[model samples]
Target: AANDLLSKAKLDASPDKVTLVIDPLIDGVTGSQSVATHLEEKRVIELVKSSYPRFQVARFSAESVAKSPIVLIGTFTAINNAGAATGPRDAYRICLALADLKTRTIISKGVARALPDGIDPTPVAFFAESPVFAKDASTDAYIKSCQGTKVGDTIDQAYADRIVVASLINDGIEAYDAGHYRDALDVYQAALKTPGGEQLRVLNGIYLANYKLHHTKAAMDAFGKVIDYGLKSDKLAVKFLFKPGSTQFSTDRSVRAPYDAWLEKISERTAAKQGCLEIVGNTSATGLPAINDRLSGLRADYVKDRLEDNEHSLRGRLIATGKGSREMIVGTGKDDASDALDRRVEFKTAKCAI
Candidate 1:
């Protein structure tokens, strides 16, 4: 229907130039890549090179795709994490990310069918002659490709987990905003107990709530969980920013432990994996660009020094980097301390590949 409207208005582009972006390929680079990647590397690229190919198809890095004029996205409707039913949250996140690319038009196979409770199914615009692959292999093909079903099931299950986590967070936040501190605590606690509870986020929220309610010890305990869980995952980093130019960590000690624990964990992991560790630094959007950059690097270096000197690692794996305030989790535009969230050090485990 949208295409028809575009054609009637003569606004659609010539079919030959339309391009598509598919899902990220996670299969090992050597494996028969997943359909999404295979189409881009083999089929789409072929079309692009085949003769102006009238219509070009390609798989692009997410960054490139986001900047492309036209893009078609292909995704299998994930049934469940176990690969049973299509997932709602995962699909929405994928679509939302693509929408971020600012493509003039986006067409989905829309196969997963259902959007989560809050997602609206507004149609996106697309250029002429672009076709998005949305259909499942015939039901028979699905059955024959035993692994196909597995793939679908996994997608759905991942979605389910994402939704579960999101929903819990939403409930907690809503309770907090409504001034129901006890209720918010209850919701957060319940979420933490759920099987796929967002351990880190929940702990963070619980700490914040306890802080607000004057439950200092409870807040500290909750903060400890954030530190513990964050330490367990290399990608998770504990960040602490100073107040503007000050060197002190957050006056809130509860806030410091999680980030500190994460750095300590990285030191421990790196010592075990590579006998050494590298710390990267980033800055929030606060100070001058040059100063922030320098400061960020220094902050990372500072963490490395602390870890190298004090951590229990046998090899004392640690390094420092300063990335001044450029990368803010939440923007630094807020009037005060919220900006502090963005200023800090991040410790990452350097993978030592054999």
Candidate 2:
């Protein structure tokens, strides 16, 4: 199927450049998992690159997409065979689309099934008669055809290292979500040892895990790394839950008390590093947009004031902005624990004259 799509995309001339964009895969059960998406995307890129060696292929980025044709890969569904009692067994429905940026149209598109680990023929056959798996046979054939080359053999060691790091980070998050702070901390530390592991996600995991374990000094140090890396990657978001529709923080004593300590640590670290900071505020989608916008700004100002009060040097180095409910990490807007992540204060490094 992949080859068919490529053939249909008939190159009048060898593409000078091709960008591969793999959208995050949609898991049938768990919705969207970034780690899984990234891994799958890498796999798709490797496969496409191996198949189309004539074109110069690169990972899609905003800067690269404007000047090249893009091969967009997305997994529509991933279903795990519950009846299979043994090793990993899953099937994925994936879509491949080629878009010509110059022509502004999708040149070729096809859907292919992907079985990462082989599935049990017995269960597959049994389900084959069912409505869901009725089309499985043809899909499986397409999947086999789409296997351009063995991914493990084609991908570079550096890319493999990134996959390892991302996997560990995902494991850490799962552990953290399950309230296993010590385990999560160990996993995050392990990830940090691998190449390409010194990332925002890994550092943030380390900080959260340390904080949960009451390792104040270690958490502080991790937070410093988070700040440094976050500056470069622009991916860090500090949690600051507030009372409903007000600037006052939530009265969760454990979280509230430690937040002050975090501010002090951040202040000292920023001052020592001579870093200018931008305090950006966000809110849950629970209120009027105008009201939320105003309240978010006030919250950012409040954080800036607190930081300035903690470290006088920060007074002239801080700027505050509000995004209201525009950039929610969680968009449920339930006004509960689930929605808490939406209300956050992010610290971004700002450029300033020395």
lDDT of 2 by residue, 101-168 (tens): 45444566666676645321111111111101011122222232223222112222232225445456
* Best TM-score among the predictions, by candidate number: 2
Per-residue lDDT value at 13 in model 1: 62
Candidate 1 has an lDDT of 0.43
The clash numbers for all candidates, in the given order, read 33, 0
Local accuracy of candidate 1 as per-residue lDDT tens digits, 193-270: 776665444666687677678887786666555544544555444545455565555565633444454445445545
Give the alpha-carbon lDDT of every model: 0.43, 0.59
Candidate 2 lDDT for residue 215: 94
lDDT of 1 at 163: 34
**Whole-model alpha-carbon lDDT for candidate 2:** 0.59
Give candidate 2 regions above 4 Å deviation.
Answer: 1-160, 174-180, 253-257, 329-332
What are the RMSD figures for all models against the true structure?
Answer: 17.6, 15.4
